[model samples]
Target: MMHLIRLELKKGGFTSYLWGSLLAYAIIACFIMVLYFTGNNLGAEGFQNYEDALNAINTFVLATFIIYASVLLSKLIINEFKDKTIHLLFAYPINRKKLILAKLSIVFFWTFVNVVLANLLIDVLFITINQIFGYVSGTLTITLLVHHAIYVLLQAFGAAGMSLLSLVLGLRKKSAAFTVATSIFIVMIVCSSNGNFNLASIIAVPLSLAVLGILITYLSFRNIDRVDVD
Candidate 1:
């Protein structure tokens, strides 16, 4: 399994994706900082404060990750099938289910890690800037920092799960367009619900997404053999 995952990593150009993730994080962080500084002028009430700014950043970042993950899954999974490379994969002396699982695992792990790291980096930068420049409101106490860390990690998990769910939908239809479109729709819904920035949403949304991802993954695994790789 480890060998297969490594092979996929090489074949899938994981390094490029890593670099892309870093670039995306930089862009998001910059955008958040801009909004933080000019939020009042932009008519964004409550965005000048640390908590609200963090919430807004989290919501946008998670949504971006959802789309990003969906694109990765499409390239790694759906494109393999569409291009008939999956036929080559199945020719190996490995269990078909395990092969698919390995691919999905790569998608999930990288997506989760990318989102978590990005969120953490943004949090650190935001707090540091606030401490130095005092642009944003609210104090970043130890407890609040810890809570933000936990919440962001949870949101990362949720984003990864939702991406996988979108993958399952796209794979079922063997349509990259469908997968990307569904991902966009899902992000829209998630962003709408996330605008409130409530404690309950932080818990409820991620948990619900995780559960849905588990179900979809199980279903995808069970039906792997039925998928027409040719």
Candidate 2:
């Protein structure tokens, strides 16, 4: 399982994607900071309250991050099948279910860590700027923080499930780009409509997605038993 996990992580291109996501996050942070610091009245209305602005930023960032996980990391699972590497992975002593779960685990863990780190960096920069302007005295409620944390967990799991579903669809249909495009479209539509995409929505969407993926994967794996890999 460890070997499979390592292989999956390597195949997912985490080293490059991680840097890319961080760079994107940094650019966004810089842009937001510029907007916050530039005192010029650009003839546009500003946020009504700090809380409103914070929530807006949080929601947008969270959604974008989830989409990132969906596209960059999760797509690799299906790519492996499209590239015909699954035979190599499954021919070893590792169980097929273990292999599938390993890929899912790596992608999920990577997504969670990346999101948390990105948010932490954003929070630090925002807090630092607020402190510079004597605006860092607001107290945070435990309930609010807990809610945000729960939302983060749900979003990550949802993206993981989406990726797994994408993999299954790709493998089953032998189309990597199609699966990726479909997953991205679904995520965009959900997020654009102001849907929470939280635990409840994830449970509804990704669980169904996972079930479909598992069914496809099982059928494919079982069918592979009768086919020649030469």
Number of backbone collisions per candidate: 0, 0
- What is candidate 2's CA lDDT for residue 202? 36
Mind giving the per-residue lDDT tens digits that candidate 2 earns over 152-204? Answer: 56555554555455555555566756666665665565445333233324345
Tell me the tens digit of each residue's lDDT in model 1 across 1-230: 89989988998888888888988999999988787667645666546466776777787788788888888889888888778888888887788988888888888888789878887888788778778767676766788778888888888778878788788788778888988998898877767654455432556776688679868788767866766554
Candidate 2 backbone overlaps, count:
0
TM-score of each: 0.90, 0.69
139 in model 2: Cα distance from truth in Å?
Answer: 5.6
Q: Pick the candidate with the highest TM-score.
A: 1
Worst 10 residues of 2 by lDDT: 193-202
In model 2, what is the error at residue 222, expressed in angstroms? Answer: 9.2
